[model samples]
Target: MNEKEILERAYLEAQKIVSENSFREFDTSLCENVDFLIDKIGSNKSIVSALATSLLKKITNPEQDIRLHRTDFENGYSARSLDTKVVTPFFKRHFPKYANKESAFLTLSTRERIKWNKNEGKNLKIRSKALKRSFLNVFEQIEDGNANPRVYLNYLFAKLQALSSKDELIFQLAKKQSGRSGVLNINLIIEMLQRHFAEKLSSRLPVVAIYSIYEILVPNLKRYDNKRLLPLQVHTSSDKHGFGDIEIYGDDGKPFEIIDIKHNISIDADLIFDIIKKTTTTSIDRYYILTTFPDGFETKEIEKAVNEFIIQTKTQKKIDIIANGIIPTLKYYLRFIDDYNLFIKKYTNNLVKDAKNSTEIKTFHIDKWIKILKEYKINNV
Candidate 1:
């Protein structure tokens, strides 16, 4: 078989393996199998090896499963550790000629190797740092090789860390490469979404909460726009209320006509009325009340209530008013809860609130509000 034919077969087999497994351990471990398939079909070793390595790297390292350790205890004991150690075998498999067997014996030659001394107290900090540095050095050597798929894969993997930092350079780079003209890398897109959402929810809340929102919205955003919209929080104070949160703006740098966000069961109608009234005074073109309990309130009832409020504002003309709750679509809600739980785990108790009874609700459900705007055909310039 030709190179193309071998690649075709290997790709099909890899797809099958990925489909059968969970997202965690899907296609990452299929490097050997992919290479074997290519070899059996008489493909070029170098090209097939590169392709197989790329596929393996692409499918492996699900960010959701990346090990995050919190060493709060003395000597840096961490509850979060990987079950299996990840060893870079490229030096052994691909660069045996360069492997320095003598380096392993250098420590032995120095006679400095010593077993753990109970009285000496474990220097876990030094040990952990040294281990991490050693592993990184090996990775560097693997990456420095010829145009192997693993080299690019490793580069991409390292780039993933920058996404969390809200690094504009990294984001721009990913956006540039996301198109047909570029690398067409989905992992970069995912990393961008994760970081975008992470930064969005990072303020006034715990990292975990932001992460939860990201998990829920990232996949949905990918489904809708093939990218995530940067969410912005707008602060406004009403005359009636001393100070409050009002609207959320999209990346377009304009606040949406309508704003929607999750709230606790105990919602303050007075505050809601104040927000609606204050919004009218400002540039807000329309109003909406989005809640977690969509089914709990009748749409007609809220509509009637809103109409009454409009009548009360006799000075201003009647405006479109939308009040409804998101029904928590199966796919979107599940992802939201997963990311929310993760966020809660990483942040403070006050920053993370249960949906049961939290009064500090704000207007920032930008994604859902966007949907509502589209549904109503309401456009705000």
Candidate 2:
């Protein structure tokens, strides 16, 4: 196919991929229109370059609204938002430095680093001129009509992979140490995911709460037909106690099962009883009390409570137990977040490199980061 045909087809394919997988709706019509122009121009490299130039202008102009929006009611919102805060800032700050330096070090044909000598009034102009120069340089190298499309695509993929690697390194380092730094790193990951990719993934609850629900439900979900489960937080009122937290539904959305997650040091018998009593009239299949302890606890204490509840109710609804020390789980989660932050940092740096390598400025890598938290062990009594 000619250059025009090639550009048109590639742009269309890119549009399809973005629309299908992107977390939000974007005006990919600019890309589509650019493709149409390329097709009309036939196969000249200059025409193809002009079309790409136009496409970049549209993407960078900020005329289109690319920001994602979602309702506050969803469970995934908070966690995802939290994750984004953790990752994006670090990436934005460090990306330019890393990319420019790396391009210089590697001596890549498509990458260049222009030195800017600062003078008080000339700082802005110098920086702007350097940026424009870098943008054009990278585009000229890649748009030669002979460079493999995969080369351009691979650049994007490589940056993402580097970021992931960097995150893993940071997490490992934190695992060996402790204090505020680790805590801050963990929080960063939570913030980054929440901000960027939370809307795309399922659940609108706070990430920690959602994770707690997932930890307890995953095994049960796997045991019973391997169905996907939805976590619900419901407040209920009973005849005696007025209103309290109760088990309202099972993993399968069935009426009979109820589960509650508590982050308290010890599970309160009165609270459990209150929940059970309130939920008594409802179609509760089973009752599960999942508690996370900062330090480990005796399962016997929880068993005693469960046994007492079972005897008192004399009801067929089974009582289950989930009691565990959550420090290790927290550690694991923190590690994941750190890794993600590092990933974003490195990825953004790569973009900076691309920007500095050309005279034509283009912005890329706009997808928000998403974290798929792994399931950890639960101490079942």
Candidate 3:
């Protein structure tokens, strides 16, 4: 078999073994199939190797551990200002030149270094701000087709793997003292799959969300209407400012409302209020905020704020917030099809890798994504 076929076969075998067994117990007795797959690590690509190893380690399924992951702790896990007052002070005292950062020694790729610089700032709050900006920059690049989110995500996953590896003992020491709520003592895949991927993809959430929902709707529409809904350029910038992250086009293809998606462990009220204010300048129907944040009093408060905005300004558009739990499903769809297609299109070509085609469809089990949705507890959505 070709390398891709071999990698796919090994990946599937390992996944099937994990799927059929309880994750906690699955780790106790790695089956011969998975053991062999894990042993063939040197041959497969990084993603394939990572997936295979994840299967053996009981990391693929979300059921194994604390699943819903957050990107930042808001505070650096310690109210003592461990990140700023403690860590930064220590660095400034002894390693004033290096600031206790590794960048003083190693050379990071120009693009990669910018992301690195964001993590080391004056304080945790500043660091968080920088982190968010850097993430949005990458998200914009992903939206612009200038960068691949999966590749960036894999870079993060690789970091997690390094932290977990025996070779990285110092990280264990750091994790102990750092009360980083974002970094939990659980499976690496959970953080990578549920948190990193979820958070990053959510930045461009509307694009991927619409694409996933479109594909799902297309097959059903064909089954019922006996016609195909050909995909079109769903998003277009209204002008230099751009109409939020998404535009709800009317029948005439003019934007009717500005649409945006924000996925966070908890919804921040100021963000919603800011979004509502921006919609007032548009003649759209309403500003739509789609989020994965669980329903709560805060969500209701967001709705109440929009109502108050209508009462105060008497604008043409209103604000609608939906915290439907479909963000995870949307992310899964992107990973399987959209992101996969992007990865292949960017790195490979027509003569080489194609997951959407005939033989590959079976070899790769691309349609199995449907089964994942059905078999898994997507009812939360």
Model-by-model lDDT, in order? Answer: 0.31, 0.33, 0.33
Across 196-277, the per-residue lDDT of candidate 2 in tens digits comes to 3234321212223334434444454534344333432222111112221233334565554444545444555665676666
Instruction: Name the best candidate (by lDDT).
Output: 2
Q: Which is better, 1 or 3, measured by lDDT?
A: 3
Candidate 3 lDDT by residue in tens digits, 29-79: 222223332233222122122222222222222222111011233311221
Alpha carbon lDDT at 340, candidate 2: 37
**TM-score of candidate 3 on Cα atoms, chains taken together:** 0.29
Model 2: lowest-lDDT 10 consecutive positions: 372-381
Estimate the TM-score of every prediction: 0.24, 0.26, 0.29
Q: Over the full model, what C-alpha lDDT does candidate 3 score relative to the true structure? A: 0.33
Model number with the top TM-score: 3
